[model samples]
Target: MTKHRIYTTSFASVYPHYIAKAEKKGRTKAEVDQIIRWLTGYNQMELEAQLKKQTDFETFFAQAPQPNPSRASIKGVICGVRVEEIKEPTMREIRYLDKLIDELAKGRAMEKILRE
Candidate 1:
């Protein structure tokens, strides 16, 4: 049998706090990596390459939401109401994101998401 290399332990130990922080905010690994790279002053391309080559579940974490005092307008009524565009949720078309996450967590192949 061939020997398998374990590359995640060092990263795991150092990144646990980041991962926990990210998960608490309900963000995906990719999104969290982006935010962290931005905050740490790393180039985006470098971060992307490293993320795919050397990363674990805990490496990605969501950034906490900023405490903005300004309010954005929300259209339509609060209860049993029809809105013009449905605003927030419809904006990103993220319905597929959940399915993707589930598949990844189940150890499904990630070649598809990488293509996009």
Candidate 2:
């Protein structure tokens, strides 16, 4: 089978879509950044640098400062797949981000969304 393109996709390309998804639901870019930082440990400056560098999702996640332990508490379905059930580690990380974004777009409070 052919490999999925998501793994190789540039985070820069998807960043705008994520921002738009949250903003459409009355969320702000800062909230989206917060969610990302909570998951990947990237501060605002680091995230901007990654975006400017056009980092791919694979590299972005691979080089993350630190994956939050609380992320394991994020239980939910994203694109019909249970985030906790995803077998591939990389895919699971991606889905965790997706689930968080979905929660943010659905108006979930930041504390709850961060699994705090």
Q: Could you say which candidate leads in lDDT?
A: 2
Clashing pairs in 1: 22-61, 22-62
Write the residue-wise lDDT of candidate 2 on 1-116 in tens digits: 66569989999999999999999999999999999999999988999999999999989999999899989998978899899998888899999999999999999999899877
lDDT of 1 by residue, 1-116 (tens): 43123222333343444455546656456654543443334456655554555553223322113211111221233224433344443221122222333333444444532222
Native-referenced Cα lDDT, model 1: 0.36
Error of 2 at 8 (Å): 0.6
Model 1, backbone clash pairs (residues 3+ apart or across chains), number: 2
Cα lDDT computed for each candidate against the true fold: 0.36, 0.93
Question: What TM-score goes with each of the models?
Answer: 0.26, 0.96
Residue 13 C-alpha lDDT in model 1:
42
* Residue 94 accuracy (lDDT) in model 2: 93
